[model samples]
Target: MSEYHVPVLLGPSIDGLDIRPEGIYVDATFGGGGHAKEIAQRLDDKGHLFVFDQDEDAEANLWGATNVTLITSNFRHLTRWMKYYDVIGRVDGILADLGVSSHQFDDPSRGFSYRYDEPLDMRMNRQQLLSAADVINQYDAVQLQDIFRSTEK
Candidate 1:
């Protein structure tokens, strides 16, 4: 019944973390907290889970998770924030689920999928200025082609 994105390869993904009961962990992309919940459940009172998510919608799902400390920022600055929180070197494991969530692709307004003819805004972080529309409209054909080609690898 939960509308949240169900994390792919849930068991194997978390297993790869090699979770320790009293260790500190980081869920770099806490979309729907699917993996975070599993990580939290395995941890005892001495353990901690730091969740980083740029999406504000994810904040609602984190409520009541006593062991979790939600950081509302992009994971690209993960090391910076970890240092700010003073958990830098103490971290036991870090898990990052990259790529757009199913929730983003399913929502027509988010403008990710070709299935829906919506605006060309494809920013996962809604606060960002550069959108898909901006790239297409602002960039020259050569620049755009070069950008696309780089991602092929």
Candidate 2:
């Protein structure tokens, strides 16, 4: 796990899954795998958990889980990714904890926080080309304002 990201709503999220000993579950945002770890503990040898995280660092957190299949991709592509993994609609439960992890915001190099003085680069998938910097530096002022307004809830 990166020093900045912390799992949130972990207890309620895992409990809500109501995991079956032999069921299949998917954690679409497997940041640090904290919730996945808890789910794995509840599963029997026959149970399976599919985890996905676009960030390469997140894959390092898959230790100690025996029956989990990890995928390196964004959760937005989950349905397709699951199909690619051959575990599509058969999933008993799907957990999607949306938003960037605390680690991403805290890590100065990740450039997720405006409060920090670093290059603007807030990409969950480091492989992606459209970074915060790219958007800000390339987009005109009007476009930047539109992006800010649209992204705001």
Candidate 3:
């Protein structure tokens, strides 16, 4: 159960970058803006941090830092966004926290953890019609097995 506001590996991860005060960085998965906030703090006025998250709820976590640019889109289009901002080849480092945040699990309505038996809407983007409930209720046992197998290494 990782905390959302608290970054998973703040110090080690940030330290590994050897961040330049005036360099550009990208937070590809800005779940709660924890990593982005840390990066923004390290950046000088010349530095820029571009953070991306598809879930509209992530927008609320954005800080009022001039160095931080919140992009309301999935990180899958990272290259496209970088090109649009003209920072494609200039990024000093990229950080991606690719895991479900505790913020989602703790919210009973989100239906991430099974402890709360709510509508199983395990979607990072609620705008999507497909949901965990739809998958479980509609998908046959064979279909579920196939899906599970697809995720195997």
C-alpha root-mean-square deviation, each candidate: 1.7, 2.4, 2.4
Clash tally, candidates in order: 0, 3, 0
lDDT of 2: 0.84
12-35 per-residue lDDT for model 3 (tens digits): 888888899999999988888877
The full ranking of all candidates by lDDT, starting with the best, is: 1, 3, 2
Clashing pairs in 2: 4-102, 4-103, 5-103
Each prediction's whole-model lDDT (CA): 0.89, 0.84, 0.87
Pairwise TM-score winner, candidates 1 and 3: 1
Stretches > 4 Å off in candidate 3: 1-4, 141-146
Q: What TM-score would you give candidate 2 relative to the actual structure? A: 0.86
Cα lDDT tens digits, model 1, 17-128, are 9999999999999988888999999999999999998987788788597889999889989899889989889999999998888788888998999999899888888888
Error of 3 at 127 (Å): 1.3
How many residue pairs clash in model 2? 3
As a whole number from 0 to 100, the lDDT of residue 67 in candidate 2 is 93
- Pairwise lDDT winner, candidates 2 and 3: 3
